[model samples]
Target: MSETHVPARRVVVIGGGISGLAAAHRLVDGGAQVTLLEASGRLGGKLYAGQIAGVAVDLGAESMLARRPEAVNLARAVGLADRLCLPAASAAGLYTRGALRPMPTGHVMGVPGDVAPLAACGVLSDAGLTRIGRDAELPRDELGEDVGIGTYVAARLGREVVDRLVEPLLGGVYAGDAYQISMRAAVPQLYEAARAERSLTEGVRAIQRRAAAGPAAGGPVFMGIDGGVGGLPLAVADAVRAGGGDIRTHAPVRRLARTGSGWSVVTEDGTALTADAVVVALPAPAAASLLAADAPGAAAELGTVEYASMALVTMAFRRAEVAGLPNSRGFLVPSVDGLTIKAATFSSHKWGWVAQGDPELFVLRTSVGRYGDEADLERDDPELVARSLADLHTTVGLTARPVATRVERWDGGLPQYPVGHLDRVARVREQVAGLPGLRVCGAVYDGVGIPACVATAHTAADELLGLLATVPAA
Candidate 1:
């Protein structure tokens, strides 16, 4: 990505989400002129925090994986370290067989390293438990480099484990079918171990041992901000401005093309901005559209990528109205259970800040829709809210209706990592590499976690910096 000798390098980041914000900030910090463009009126994409019944709450993602330093480190770098907070209770449960069962530990993506808990908890039937015991004795034969997580786990363990345990856990993350999700892309540690170890349990045990040896291994798995995870992008944008970068919302980039010694970005409003380098931090579809003419091969591959959409319905109720709420954080439902709602979180019970201002208002959230379940989200807000309350009533036995409800629909929110997704992404990058001073970074590429996205932003910025290294000063 090296550039020819030039003076006063300018950069245009075509997105205002967290990743775009990170890129713009990095360019500014490098003394490069930067301009950030966002299509919507708001800055944060899925990291939105708003109010419900006068109590502040997050309508999108509320927490982030703390073990990954990309997100937390960036938060601290943007002067938001003081606002960091951890979840009150990290314990979770699985709502299946019409009851809540404790989530078994010592597993990576619900692939239990120890099966004793599964036997005692009755998460799997007696016959299902018997199948698990046969894992160690299975044939030590050929397992491909990239295989479906559910298919491989079921072959080693059993179908019951994949359906009952692994399915729900993976579903909560990608909202895609487990049998089609890539093991290499989704869970690399487990995939790496499976290559050498004959037994899946043994492989998981080895991975856990390596993780526990890390510096921050024993701490809570996830964390949140004082207000919400949304504060992250807001703070980063402020830092970008402070460092002399321009951020424009409602300015969508429509196309990208190479200039004499730089790149040009065309916005929806017919605004043309040329820069020494450009970093595309957008979803696969949108990115593909802009790059169709410049990098058609990459665009074609990006067009093949699939996405899953879901809705988060936040509801607040009077504490007295919903009596006897449990101390647990949340519960997840398996798709096999034939339920409308996939998961629900007791927000007030999970976050201390949300519970601080309103002692009487108990806030909670319900998630609906998955890879193949978009019908539920199409329903009106009242219908979706009703279905969510019904699921709560059926499982937790809650009778009170919500005093305040907010519905946030994220269409095509999570990018699906189907089998061979990583290879496809590699090809996309390879195709784009032929074009100088142009790079793509977003949740669609490396990972969907906040940390992964930020790290990708850094990588893209470094690529741009690599180009700037060759430019000559006037």
Candidate 2:
């Protein structure tokens, strides 16, 4: 390939979220002609930056995993790298057993390395502590090819560990049941180590040691932009256009079909664009519908993928009313608490930039609803906010009235990766591989975080470009 070799491939990307934007950016950056279509009027599906009480903050996804370089790299490529910022506070709390206790250390997603720390944390009862002691003595069981995170962890550490420690952390991320979420897909490193070590505690210790040796182990786990994560998509989309890619909002892809050596993508408005390759970076359901005609197996598998709906209630309160608030970042409520809200983040305390805009005003957000439990979302916005405020008063001693409130609802925000998710992804890829120039990527197929979506998009873009490289130029 020449240094300035321009590929004859015209790639059509369907979807307007970060995944699609990243794919388009990669394709265009690779010197390929591209056309990007989005169903919505604006880009950045789950990431939106908005103002509450004249203070700018992220109304959607606030941060990205810094350990993974895809998101950070994309930010740099789009000229927002210098704007990245870390959280002001790192420690988080767990509201369980009628008190707000410190989260345990030396664990990965509630999987503990030593039982003493868990006992010290007081999140567990005396009975739970007793069970943790007997964990290592338990007989070794047959390890399966794949299993649920709750099933495997509960079996080794007992139900108390899974309920108190594991569930809350996992719930905060997946918004799904621990027993149904895939151990392999959700936390593959720990699950894979569990297969090698007979004792789960020992396995976790080994995993921790390996992490400690790695360069990124003790570094800040997450990062956010100075403005908001929502700005990331817009910057990348701008870069895509600057690279000569055509990006159109409200151009939802209606039909995608193979045309001889290339593919033809039709928009909802009946506009057709023929391209040498096609990348479908969308939700599982939407991707399934578009791929049903050509890759029925993949489509069927995609259709089986489930999702979890959630709502975020952002509230701004007078600073004096929350004077005696906890100094930590936030607190997570386990389902066992029977609380309407699952988690809450103190935005003003967590992000210094959010506070810089208004020091006298305190801002926070509470998340409601999950995979199988969405009754909380059915209530009106006022009802949800009242419940959240009530819980905050009880948990952290807040007696404040909000100056402003914003409620954002995501019907199917998170895709539930059930057991055998990795295997299912493999099958989908195998089926799609049979097609010459078709590919799929997004939160549905790979990881759900911002970095994971970007990484998947880059992979899809590379795959399509590779296929085009093999073809003879027109």
RMSD values for the candidates in order, in angstroms, are 2.2, 1.6
lDDT of each: 0.87, 0.89
lDDT of 1 by residue, 373-459 (tens): 688888999999999999999888899988989999999999999889999999999988888888889899878888899889988
lDDT for predicted candidate 1 compared with the true structure: 0.87
TM-score of each: 0.97, 0.98
lDDT of 2 by residue, 1-474 (tens): 112333657889999899999988988877899889999999999989999999998989999999998999899999997899999989999999999999998788998878788878898889877877777898876778789999988888788888888888999888999988888899988887888877788888989888889999778899999988999999999999998899999888899998777888999899988888889989999999999999999999999999999999999989988889898889999998888889999999999989997999999999999889998889999998999999998898888889899999999999999999999999999999898888889998778999999989989888777767778532
Error of 1 at 79 (Å): 0.9
Q: In model 2, which regions exceed 4 Å deviation? A: 1-6
Best lDDT among the predictions, by candidate number: 2
- Using TM-score, give the best candidate's number: 2
Least accurate 10 contiguous residues by lDDT in model 2: 1-10
